[model samples]
Target: MRLPLGLTAAAILFVLTMVGGAILDQLNENMHVRYRDASVALERLEHASERISGLLREAVLDRNVLLTVGYDNLNRTLDTTLNNLEGLAESFGLSREVNLLGLRRLELQDIERRCLKLMDEDRWGEARDLLFGEDFALSRKLYEIDTENLVSVLDDRLRREATRFATARQASLGVRGLALILLLTSGVLFSRRLTRELAEQKRLQRELTAARDELEDRVRERTRELEHANRQLASLSYMDGLTQVANRRRFDVAYPQEWDRAVRHGYPLALLMVDVDQFKAFNDHYGHQAGDQCLQAVARVLRDSARRSGDIVARYGGEEFAVVLPGLDTRAAVAVAEAMRWAVESMRREHCVSDCADVVTISIGVATRQPKPHQEPAELLAEADKALYRAKSAGRNRVMVWSGEDVSFYI
Candidate 1:
């Protein structure tokens, strides 16, 4: 009679174990479905965000109107995804993150509107500026940070849920070991699936990180290229196109800065106003191209003769060049002028139409002054001009120095 009772108890226990194991299996299936759904939704959100970023970046640099359409569709998709995301966030107790995402979405919409308006108006420069502006950069950075944070929070919660699921599986295993032996196989399969999915998730995260890094490197390279181009443009702006020397604008800027330094240091600043002898006649005799060549040759000579790094050689205007010699006295300045004059005479480039020599020549006027605090740089320039007049009046190929109010020929 006892053996029969023991057998009946064992049977009851086995039936109870089977029922409990089935319930646990159902719960695990429900949990797995929710996890899968959340993973799919998060992936959709990531794709949409990445698409929006790429489309907007491309739109800023390119004038393709089609990108606008592409992004607009993505925006609609993003709205739907965000709604789903918000529901999930709320379920996961991430209401604050949801609010932040909503705010960022509105900001992104405003940016898009402004960008689209600029595109419609054909204001690509302004659009580029707006997109690359500090505010826009900051906005994008904040949005990305918020997104990463949301992803991290969701991943953390999911990991906790997975841990709970694992614990429940272990408990089910212990309670129903004899009756639900088949569940061991199911548990092993589920574990393998979870491991594979986690690995895939990690791979996706790594890819996203790599992509972001590549984009940043590209941005940096582009910025460097733009900076180099700007520098080239700025340098070109100050150079004479014909002679490949400093233009009048550069002279104008350097002259005052040098003058201020001279005034402060109590050193003499010298100016040489040089003009090609009979340049107009030379242009008429030799075509304009030859005339330009003549000017370039003279400019090259003047640049070479300056010698000192502090000296400046500039194309002051038509057929005229100016040289600034800082810390040079009148005598030293006259010596430089004479050297330049002698070099051109030695070159002996044939100039049959000249009244001076049979070769091309230049007339130089040298003026040096220890500038006073109250004096203007123009005063020195005028003195140099007067000396230049004296050089031209005296002879075609000579240097004249300004002596107070008078001009003296430099020997």
Candidate 2:
């Protein structure tokens, strides 16, 4: 299941809080360890500095005592103390200031060397002068001051580090306490809210399911009603108003299918383009209402004349009708057109305004071809139109067949 954005954010925040708490605890522990290590180093440094100062005082009190003590022993002690000071400095993490301490140690060694040289020459005065010289006195005083400053610095650093550790520890404790409280509160609230939300989600899901089922039932009922209405609409769209024959649109749609079936069966397809002779004059003289009745009678004749089940009769346009006959050759098409013309002549409807003596007549153009593998529907339509023009020109009230040789007339 996927959580909402708000819930996901809350989960992420909870994880981050836990991670932060753990990091704070680790930092606090590290600070305590560092402070303890620093304190130990500071104490060692202070003790070592005091020992070095005591050795210097002893050397000052009795210059002859250095002979009894042996120069090697004193030098060894000083060297050991210097090494200890270096170690202490390192332990205290004062690597950057180690050089200053080393320089002071070197100065002490140079003083010892000078004292040894004087003792070899047995010149007490020069040795005393060398030990108590202004330069040496100044160097010793500077060394003492440096040691005191080091002690003061170490004390201050220890105090500061202690204060820092205390602050950090206290802060960590406060943060942990607050995080614990927040975690408990958030967990409790989230759990309660999650339960409530789940219940609400369940209720909503049930309502949605019920609504969807009801909607589906209504949709099914509406679908049956629409299907019945559609069947009625289809009938109206295809049937001609006057003759109850197929209309042009329906004929156009059905023609292609029939033509394809004829091609598959290697049969002939024929088309007849029929027009009422002098229809315009008849409409002008007999009135439009009479002309309409005439057109209806003509359509009925065409419908009765097309005998085959595969044949379709349709009103092509004003005073023109088309007949599509599958499995009909040129002879069959001509015979059907002649029969339709006779049917109209038998009507005996008078057209007093028309120059022709006939009551009503029809001019029909017939074209027939056996469907071939690559024959296009356009080619057949063009042939039929050519035949139609020929029928119109050769005097109306006759059937004319398209001849393939008349290229110019067709073009």
Candidate 3:
């Protein structure tokens, strides 16, 4: 069943308190075990040191013996004592305390050295006298010190373990009391709080779901509106306003794709740039409004003349237009240029500045090339512009094609 947060927290607190009590109890038991083990190790060390000291005392009392015999027995006893002390220190993890034990062991070592020195000098009586006298006394004193240190370590360990046990016991009691309080509080408040919170949560969940659904619907409507707006913007971006044909922006976008395709398929692509002759003079004679009408008419003719599906006709700017045709060679491009020139001439608009006749004629430049790697769009336009200049130089109302090899002026 569902429950309020406060009640849930109280129950969780109760469970955590019980778990913590169990952990603390286990820790206290481990501390007791360690204390017991340390005490046992200390007792063993004390007994071993006492036994070794008793042997040294017995050897010293027998002063009539040769120095070699006493030295050998004492050396063996010292070795055995050192091994036992090291083993005990390791088992108890008492490396720092072992340093003190090491100092005591050094006293036994000094006694052995003195015995060897007496033997080297061939002074057996003096060596026996030293062993029975100061050396034996030092050995007994070191043994007493070792026993005292072990007792002190054991006492300290016991105190620490006792303190730890007491602290854990107190903590366990406190935690148990808190757990009982938490459990009781949870039990008392569970029924009414659980019922109220569950109802509130359900109400909030329903409200949130309704709000989410409303937001989704609004988003869908906004998405549809944006899609329609994007289509209108795309159309306006690519189409000329006056002529309803492709604009220069659209031509620029399509030209690169066509050029790449031509190169891939080893086909020819052609460009035609057309300009109206004496258009400024015509505008000056008639007016800006009539000049616009003439431009619209020319735009219609260019659009209609682009019969191939791959042809693009665009209003480049005032009094200028461009056409792109794919899969067309130079000869075919020249024919298309001528057709466009004649179409513009057919309009028969009068212009007094015309050198050939009193007619509005278009000068056309055609450039055709099989697309190649590293060819740029500006190269094609430059060729077409050069050809257009040639057509104008040869008298307006004519078409010219760029020969890839020579820059000769042509008509």
Candidate 4:
């Protein structure tokens, strides 16, 4: 009777183990299929974006096609991609991305039309400008952002799948252990140690549960940290790495917002275009590393000088920097520019190669315009830039204002 009971227990445990393994295998297969499908969809969308961009470049920049063939092909391919994305969105619950892509495709079509017309006219420069304009660049940026978001979403899903897989594995293992205990009980029902063994099994089960819970809690905490890191990384995109100030991208964003606000309030918007005097000579003299340090120091001075809540100092490309002074007239703006110039000069960073001054100095052009209807804020920036040129041409280390006057001398 004991032998028969032992055989029966072994048979039941073997069957349960096989069934658990089959279930786990099936779950794993389903998870893999879903992950692969999502990955493939994202890759296809990327392929579409790259292909369209390439065709647009070839048609516009190279003028490889004299006709509208490229445009036709681009439209067809984008339509197909849109259709595919619609299916994927329904299956993957990506409706938001699909809507955004639709809008992007519409904008791309308009841009392509304008570019192809220019190419047809044999005006290559205009074609290139239209193709590479802010609109086109913005569309590409949006697509890139969307692609990253899609990839992130897919990665999150994959992580969730991994967690589910692990949970399933733990549940199967627990069930197998319980089955084994049942088998042992059947074969050793009359043993005096049965109760003690069961008590030990209960303790082991408690430990396993605790370990799983702890592991899950740790994963949650790590996920939160990863999320915070991602946000910080995004913010860094708009920051100048060396000087720790706003970069050109941040400047672009701020410019439009401030311009609109000033326009609404009918206030004068002032812009200061600041240039480090003989910066290239300074770089040639001291090497790029020192040049970077000089830039950082100058940025600090500019930032300190314009500490108003509305003042924005951003590193415009290379050694150039810009300060936007909203609500200030040309005179007040000029005063701020003079302060910035003196602050930088006081740093006395040696620039023996500079023809302007032996110490580091800055040239500034201040322009102020009352925001008017149907007028662009860029006009103001252009005036400030022209004034900056005049400052440099006259002599470096001075503040000049562009007030619709001849800028032959420093004011």
TM-score of each: 0.56, 0.45, 0.46, 0.61
Question: Between prediction 2 and prediction 4, which has the larger TM-score?
Answer: 4
Best by lDDT: 1
Cα error, candidate 4, residue 115 (Å): 17
Superposition TM-score, candidate 1 onto the true structure: 0.56
Model 4: residues >4 Å from true position, as ranges? 1-7, 10-205, 405-411
- Whose lDDT is higher: candidate 2's or candidate 4's? 4
TM-score of predicted structure 4: 0.61
Better structure of 1 and 4 per TM-score: 4
| Residue-wise C-alpha lDDT for candidate 2, range 1-411, written one tens digit per residue | 565455566555545654664675566555545544444444444444444444443344334344234446555655565565566566456654555755765786687577657755666667667766886777766766666666666667667766775676566556544544443455554666655644774797699699879978986897798678668766765776766788766777888888899889998999888888899999988888988999999988888888678889988767888899898887777888888877888888886765554588888887889878798876787788778878777767677888575842221
Report how far residue 209 has shifted in candidate 1, in Å: 0.8
RMSD of each candidate relative to the true structure: 15.4, 47.4, 39.8, 9.3
Candidate 1: segments with Cα more than 4 A from true spot: 1-186
- Maximum-TM-score candidate: 4
- How does each model score on lDDT? 0.80, 0.69, 0.72, 0.78
In model 1, the Cα lDDT at residue 334 comes to 89
Superposed Cα deviation of residue 371, candidate 1 (Å)? 0.4
Q: Write the per-residue lDDT of candidate 3 for residues 1-411, one digit (tens) a residue.
A: 777565567657656765776687677666656555555445455544544443343333333223135445555654565566556556446666666766766776677567557656766666667666866677757766766777687667667767876787677667655645554566655556545644774797699699879978986997798678668866765777777888766877888889889989999999998888888888988899888888888888888889789899987776878899999998888888888888888888877876766988999888988889988878988898888888888887899888865664344
> Which is better, 1 or 2, measured by TM-score?
1
